[model samples]
Target: MTDTVTLSLADLTARVETIFRRAGMNAAQTRALTSVIVAGERDACKSHGIYRIEGALRTVKAGKVNPLAEPVLDAGEGTAIVRVDAKGGFANPAFELGLPVLAARARELGLAALVINDCTHFSALWPEVEAVTAQGLSAMVMCPSYATVAPTGGNKPLLGTNPFAFGWPRADAPPYVFDFATSVAARGEIELHRRAGKPLPEGWAIDADGNPTTDPEAALEGAMLPFGGHKGAAIGTMIELLAAIMIGDLTSPEVLDYLGTTTLAPFHGELILAFDPARFAAGRPGNPLARAEVLFEAIVGQGARLPSQRRFAARKISESQGVTLTAAEIAGLDRLTAQGLDAVA
Candidate 1:
C-alpha cells in the first residue's frame, strides 16, 4: 500500500470543513478557517496547514474562541478606517467581512485601514495580503501573537513572534508579497522541528538559561530570538504598539497573561492597511504599476527571486495535481474528524 494520499483541493476543503463542523464551529468559522487551512496545504506551508487543527480545537474546547460568532463590520462612514469586531471568533471571517469595505475606502480615499479586534488568529498573513492585492491595491498587515520571543539582549520572553506582511499588485503576474514573523524563526517552525525530532538551526532560540541552543523543546520552553537581533525586536515591538495598543486590543504580554499558556491560540487583534496605487499616482508621470514591473524585471535579471514565488509555484502544482499527505497525516485527519473536540487533548 502507498504511504501517502493525494486529494483534490475541493476534497481537502470538504474534509477540513467536516472536521471543524464536527468540532462545533459555526458556518462562518468553519468556512473561513477551512479556506486558510486549505490554502496553507495548497501552498505547501505545512506549518499553517492541517497541522494547526488540533490547536484550534483545543482553543475551542478551552472556551478561548467563540465557535459561533458572526463578525460585525463598522464602515466608518466618514473616515478611512474600517473596523470589524470578530466578536470572539476567528480572524479569518472578520477579515473577509471587512475586505470589500476596506478596499472601497482605499479606492475612495487613496488609503484605508481595517482593524480586527477580539479574535484568535493563527494563520499566515500572506493570504490576507494577497486578498487585498487582488483588488488592485497595495496592502500591509500585522498582528501580535502570544509572548514567546525575547527581545535582543534580553533573557526572557517579552515579545510575540509578531508577523508582518506587505503586498503590491502586479498587472501581469502574481502580486509582489512577503510575510514573515519578526522572530528568527516562527514559533510554528520550532514546533514542527520538535514534532519531527529534529534539531533547530543555531541562533534560532535560547535555552531557559539564556544560552544558544538547537533543541526545539528547550527553545519553546525558554524563548525564541528575534531575527536580526535589534531590528526584529523593534519590529515586533512596533506590531504591539500599532496592532495591539493603538487598536485597543491585547498586546503580547496581555495575551499571554490572559491565556496563561501558549498551547492555545492567542486572543488579539489585527491591522490591515490598503492603498490605491492609481489614486495615489494620479498626477505622477509614469504608471506606478509599470514602474514596479521594470523593477521586478531587473531584480529577476540579476538571478534573484521574488517573495511568494515558491509559494505561488507550489500553489500551481497543487491546483493541478492536488495536495499530497503522508499516511500518518491522513490518519491524524481521520482521527480528528471522527473525535472532534475529544481528539484535541
Candidate 2:
C-alpha cells in the first residue's frame, strides 16, 4: 500500500544525475541539482525528496531553471555585507554556484549576511546549518519567495513558505541544528498528498475567498495558512522582507510571472547570516569548547533536545529496516529514469 522504496544514496544519486544530464543538463548543473535532491531524501525530508524530481524536471523541460546558472562572489565587503552576483545563469543556483559562495561570503564578512537572488532550492536547510556549525560559527539562513498564502484569519496568498535555519557550534555530538519552514505546511508536502491522491489535513491552506481548503488543487490556488496563525504570518513576512526587500533579488511581481510560466520555478532572494563564535567566545580561554560540551550533554541527555533528533532516529530505523515505497511511486521513478527496476539493482 505504501509507495516508498529504498536505494543506496550514492547509487540512486549517480543514476539520477545521469538521467538529468541525459535530459540536457550539464555536468555541473546535474551534480548540483541531484545533490540537493539526494540530501533531502537522505535526511528524510520527503517533501523535498525524489518526489520532487518530477516537478524539477518540469521546470527544466519548460526552461525555467537554467541548468547552467553558476554563481560568483565578491569578497571585498570590509565592513558591510558580502556581495554576490548570479553569474548570468550558468548553472542551477543551489550549492554548486550559489550556496557555497554565500557561505564563503559569510566567512569573509565575520558578521556577514550573504544574499542570493534568482537562485535554486538549497534542499534541506539543516545540512546547510550543520556545515556552518562545523566551522565553529553561528549561522542563520532563510529563503523567501513569492506569495503562497494570505494573512492569518484572512484568505489572500501573499508569501511563500519561508524558512529560517540556525546552527550553533556544539562542543560534542552534532551541532545543535534548527531548521523548519515558517508555514503550517510546505507546498512540497501538498504536492506529495496530491501525487498519492490523498486529501490534505485541515489548517494547511485556505480557499480563493480566504476559507480553508483540503483539495490539493484548490489549496494550490488558495492561500497557505501560517503555522501559528497570525504570529507565524508575521514571521513569514519578516523572512520575505529580509530575503526579498532587503536583498532586492525576488519580488512579488516576478513571482506571479514565474508562477504563470510553468517553466521557471525558482528559489531566489535568499539571506544567509553568519557569525564566528570563535570570534566571540574563543578568546575566553578555560577550554570554552569544554564548557559548551558540558551544556550540550546535559540537554541532550534529558532528551529536551534540538530540532533534528526525530529525523536522526528515523534515519537509524530506515537504515535497519529500509525505506518503504509504493509500487506506483516505484513505477513513477521507472518512468522518470526510463530505467525500469534497474535502479533497485
Against the true structure, whose TM-score is highest? Answer: 1
Candidate 2, overall lDDT? 0.67
In model 2, which runs have C-alpha deviations exceeding 4 angstroms? Answer: 1-6, 77-80, 87-109, 188-202, 212-221, 261-264, 282-302, 314-331, 339-345
lDDT of each: 0.95, 0.67
Backbone clashes (count) for model 1: 0
RMSD of each: 1.6, 4.7
Best by lDDT: 1
lDDT tens string, model 1, 213-276? 9999999888999999899999999999999999999999999999999899999999999999
Q: Model 2: per-residue lDDT, tens digit, 63-166?
A: 55666655666654454465556543322343334345545655555566665556655456666677667767787978775577677877777777778888
